[model samples]
Target: MKAKERRNNIKNLLINSSNPIKGQELAEKLGVTRQVIVKDIALLRAEGKKIIATPEGYLVTKNQENLITKIIAVSHNVEDIQDELETVIKFGGIVKDVVVEHSVYGEIKAMIMIKSLYDVHNFMKKINKGKGEPLLVLTGGIHLHTICADNDEIMDNILSELKNKKYLIY
Candidate 1:
């Protein structure tokens, strides 16, 4: 894999993982050298990924310094996905993750990490072109998004906008 794609994969793995992952484990998982993993870690850190080296291994911080997060319930049809994501991005909120409660499985979550309109468009294209179905379909368009911002003001603005757009639930 290319360095950029590999770094993105590394970020996705770290973001989705609930536990720390050792460098060697990452290396083996990505079919690269341990040294490459180490360099990728450094590059990711330089790019403000909030990756910290723990005694166990490397763990991506869910709550970074000065970052405020809010989970909001929303219900919208699949066709409105881009509009919903664009709304969040326009308000300066980072789309951190999506969560849905399943009747049989309980809470199911996926890391989105969408920070810009480009990312949102890419996500929409991937979903539209591929067979990958959105988790919201399993929950009748009702779901939750973990939005992050540098402060509460931005978050409040996002919530208000979503509410005005009829995306926010309650």
Candidate 2:
């Protein structure tokens, strides 16, 4: 298939699928190298496609008309990461991203997109396998998360749970 046709197919696939599609999977489907898919994704983004690269794969950003988004400050030890994420998901919140203030960079953010226990497990596995440090380490375990939920009540419940666990910064 031509490059333009392949990109259009990719866009269609992303739009129709709810889950993030891995580059390797896309490459296999397109009979191309994973690098090609990466480049295609970059080109798509250049054209103003709202594609987000999550740990699992690539997905188009969905409209948030009915969702409530809030930034919450949290602090916890590295070991408590799972519990913190679980609390948010349990209260119906999707942890969209984690942000931290960096002395040099000012602010750094990572797309988390953790919405379930499965996502949390995969996230922790990736971190452990890569020996990756959480961005919270940059600021002594203090960070902010952009969480989205069905409504204000769900977000409030998430915050209440985090507060009970002493994870909320305030």
Candidate 3:
């Protein structure tokens, strides 16, 4: 009912959620407007919460303690987007984000947080539903993805698969 209480509730929801929660979904659950959710998120961040706004929605960044995180360079057309994402997921890697380098804008990144086949499907669907081009389009189909896995074997296998599929950039 109050601003402080609402922000606490927002943090609780993010902590318990396994998947990203859309702003609208949060607003609906909290009986507030989407703008309020946005403001709450900003305020939460100001409080040093690890809430990350991904393309799918809002997620609290998990601890990478003892986890292996690596960045992979890849190149592919928009149509191969699903396949590339699927490959990473297939090899037990969590696609954390996509990064691109623009000549004028330097480097830009976005949180993807793709962890499953369903996530891959949902990401592709959203891209198709929107008119905006993938970030790779800005750099001629070249980009990087930060992936996380449990061990070296999984990371090695993911890299091998991406390389085999011609998506991995040497």
Name the lDDT of candidate 1: 0.87
Writing each residue's lDDT as its tens digit, candidate 2 over 1-170 gives 99999999999999999899999999999999999999999999999998989878999988866799989999998889999999999987899999999999999988889998999999999777876888988999999999999988998899988999999986
Error (Å) of candidate 2 at residue 5 is 1.3
Error of 3 at 67 (Å): 1.4
lDDT of 1 by residue, 49-77 (tens): 89876434677987656788788899999
Q: C-alpha displacement of 61 in model 1, angstroms? A: 5.3
Distance from true location, Cα of 84 in model 3, Å: 1.0
The reply for model 3, stretches above 4 Å from the true place, is: none
Q: What is the Å distance of residue 44 in model 2 from its true position?
A: 1.9
Q: Which ten residues in a row have the lowest lDDT in candidate 1?
A: 54-63
Q: Flag the better candidate by TM-score, 1 or 3.
A: 3
lDDT of 3 by residue, 44-122 (tens): 9999999999877898987776789988899999999999998888978899999999999999999888999999988
TM per candidate comes to 0.66, 0.91, 0.91
**Which stretches in model 2 have alpha-carbon errors above 4 Å?**
none
Error of 1 at 16 (Å): 19
